[model samples]
Target: MARLKIADNLDGEPQTAEELAVKTHTNAPLLFRLLRALAGLGLVRADEEKRFHLTPLGRTMRTKGDGAFGDFMEMFLGDQFLPWTKYVDAIRTGKTQFDQLYGVPYYEHLKKNPDERGRFVNGLKQMTKIFNANITDYYDFTPFKHIVDIAGSDGTFLINILKNVPHARGTVFDEEPSIEAAKKNVLDYPNVKDRLDFVAGSFFTDPIPAGGDCYTMKSALDFEDELAIQILKNIRNKMKSGTKFLVIQTVVPDTDEFHIGKLFDQYLFMLTGGKERTKAEAEHVLRGTGFELNRIIPTTYPLWDILEATAV
Candidate 1:
């Protein structure tokens, strides 16, 4: 991953191990060994000329491609590395390891460091591009006149949804930095820029913007029960009684199924005071927060599901 970033695949040139080591500021011999392993894995190949070229699999980690797996890789390994190393301890204790490792809450740490917050938010933005594509293609938004995305950075999801709805306007309720980033990176598209509004505040404290027929939370509800319910209750206070609510999340299955969400739940265990909830747990959480489960909308993706609900 570091090599992909160092090579900056946009350059479209094969690099010698020496050149790559220099570019990435690593020892040439060490870099060659790493590259050789990657070669063995077939993510890259070396020519007789001793120049390494990215393979199709390697290109998946380049930002130039249609895939956002690069950002996903960076976001996880870059930002969440330390806490993940302590996952074993977290699993044994059922406590947050992020706060323990960092000496502050993850969100609090973010608020104090704008650069990291920007990187993390942009990572999510990159991933959002693909998520929004699948959602707009498969879901129906024709009947909804307005949409609000909680903690939606750059309004990417809302912008895509509004593009489809045409007449719909949307709100992005997120951090101030995220609002700025969205303005610069996401809302420039002519279709939805004028129709989108950004409300800057922490969802843990603020009331969500009102008058939306739908509220979307994409990985935003991965908080402990009380805090998650507080956000829902806050949204409920501002929303009309019958407003639709959507949680696009890793809703864990109750079975001893060998699903990836189980791994994700474990990762969440390391980073948060939350775990991926089962359907019954989801229903319980939502019910306490002024919402009722309408349906669980399955998408083509296995790790994510759209849990539809109605504001009570």
Candidate 2:
């Protein structure tokens, strides 16, 4: 539906499959079958006249909306979905199948393919909007005056944080692709426009911007311990002692009580040869990189949390 733009064409008003087929440019017979399937899933309902209307649930598939999941569905089930075919091979070789198939890491793949990159970044923005909505409420940011979001993509999370922290300014540290995207994203938030800055560089090679009392990395340290430690140490060397370091990502539960991170860990491995860590695993990496893990602050969202730390 997303690929054909069928969902976006649907309004609450009833329309027959032939009408939808005209808009979406698909065969009327095939469209009717799909519409019937959608109705089975409660995304739409057909009347006696065989005209279908989008249910509230179906409207979430629209490309443009406040709570739309169209991009999320498109990316996860579209671009990212292809890598799953290599899952068994990946497990056998302990490698990212995406890298094997595409001849580069997922991030590198994004750099090579502009169209896919655009979709991936937009999908991430949409996903962040959904998951990181309550992060500011869960963690206090008023005390920190300046925050530097390391490897912050498009600055969506930083912008969300700065919107809540009126007194705090922030800088988003990322590569050129993300910095370019962040430049455009920052324009949407006029209130925090003056306070946010985007710095383009790699945390592994470039000198991190100094003087921020707080630094944050949301889902940025999912790489192997050595690589994650290198990035963390780079930040540690640049920032002063006692500066707060917030690692805002999921820590796999020690117990077997189900959590999304358990499954997402495999996805991370597929994309970057990285895996989600348990609390102990996270602390081991942090401690090795000259930071002390203070506590894990839970957000309302199950998969998100703040791993509060201090540069020692």
Candidate 3:
């Protein structure tokens, strides 16, 4: 389905089977057979002249190059697909198969390979838009004077919030690479220039800046549990007793449904050696880290749930 999506642009020009096969690196006959199946499923359509075009479902999958579906598929089919063959071994061993399949851990692989890191970051940017609208709308930023966005990449989410809430100031804290990228993103927002500050350092190693009423981690805690806890504890140590800790993450649904959040959980396991937690699991982690879970606010979108906590 994704291959067909890449083949058919929004202009509705149908690529030949050979062209699609070359693009997807599949055999021509196999690609045509798959397209036939998709046509039967109403995912693709064949005109009277036998040219393939997108059905409504297929069109949705194409997503104008910046869609969440494209990002999701890219991450799924890119580097993460290799570890699924050893998933049973991982389950039996209770260890990540990614390290076994590849020569190194997933994060190590990402750091060593710039191409994979670029793909990962691009996918993250695409996926962030899925929940950004809800994040900007559901949370009340007016009350907070200064917000420190820990591990905030490119400052897209913070910039969106700063634009909406006129009184709120923001500080984007991330690694040097992300901070460099964020500088470019913040150039147009000169009105918020005084309020926006970029700090580049590891949240686990460096001290979180004081004087912020609200501290946020946007999809940042899903990496390593101990590291995540250490970062949270560091922030808690710096913050006042009543400071609000906003964790913007995808809350895993209880059922085994095919939610995007569940798929993202699988990606996390395959790529970062992390797991997306349920609301109960999130509360457990927070409590273990000396934070009191306040509320799990459901966003307007299904992919995200805002878990608000406070230092105990």
Candidate 4:
């Protein structure tokens, strides 16, 4: 789908099969047959005149719409999809199928392939955009003089916070490539650029950027228990007493009831040795890593929550 930009091309207004194929450079007959199947599935609607436009469901497939889920579709349907082929191998051997499929860990594989990294990062961008849009509205940042976002890709979280709380200055900490991407994105907000700076280093290996009263990480702890605690400890080591730390993730619940985190945990099981955790499990990491759990703030966005903590 990303190859021919099939869904993307269709979003350029309704078109006949000939028109779509001509615009997208595909065989007209074959494209029409494919469109026919999609139409039956309610992804697209056909007019009596044979023009096709996106159904409400198909709008989610476009690359530019607010509802656009193409980034996720690109990632899951590409590199993330490969592991499912060896899923049984993962279950049988109790290992990450992604490592089996790519001969490297998931993160290392992305480091080797820039194209795949871009797609995966785009998927993250989508989720953070949603999280950032609603975050400041719910969580007060006014008390903080300086804020640090650990592993903040593209710096959207801090950018939104800096905008909302004008007295606040923010630092974005991430790896080299993500820091570079954040710098480019920062250019779009020259007015707020002074309040923002980027740091390039490993959150696990490097010292956490110092002097921010508020430290935040979003969706960064979807790791196995040991590594997750280690990551929190690394951050805790840098925090002065009373420094506030915010960890945002899809906080699962300890229940047999159905939840999206249960599904996300399964996806992680196949792709990495990581898994989503319940609120209790998340709080355990805080206590074990030398931080005091303040509260778990659930958001209007289901499954996502902020675990507020403080360095002891």
Candidate whose lDDT is highest: 2
After the best TM-score superposition of candidate 4, give how far the Cα of residue 134 lies from its true spot, in angstroms: 1.6
- Candidate 3 residue 207 Cα shift, in angstroms, is 2.3
Candidate 3 ranges with C-alpha deviation above 4 Å:
1-10, 14-31, 63-68, 220-224, 253-267
Number of clashing residue pairs in every model? 0, 0, 0, 0
Candidate 1 lDDT, 21-140, residue by residue in tens: 777777889878888898898777899998899887777676545763676567776557888787788878877999998888888988887766766765666666677877877678
lDDT of 4 by residue, 1-312 (tens): 445677788885899999999988999999999899989988888899999988888877766668777786777876888888887788898888888778898888889998899889987776566778879877999999999999998888788888888888999999999998889988888767998988899887898899999999976569887778778888988889999999888888787898898898889888778988877777787888888889988888765788889999
lDDT of 2 by residue, 1-312 (tens): 677776788765678999999988899999999999999999989999999988888888877777887886777764578889989998899988887887888877887888888788777677778766667778889999999999898888899889999889999999998998889989999999999988999988799999999999987568877789888888999988899999988889889898999998998888788889999999999999999999998876666788999999
Q: What local distance difference test score does each model get?
A: 0.79, 0.86, 0.76, 0.84
Clashes of 4: 0
TM-score of each: 0.93, 0.93, 0.85, 0.95
Per-residue lDDT for 163-255 in model 3, tens only? 887898999998888899999988888877677999998787898878889989877568668767777777788888788999988888798
Clashing pairs in 1: none
- Can you tell me which runs of candidate 1 are displaced by over 4 Å? 3-7
Q: What is the lDDT of residue 290 in candidate 1?
A: 86
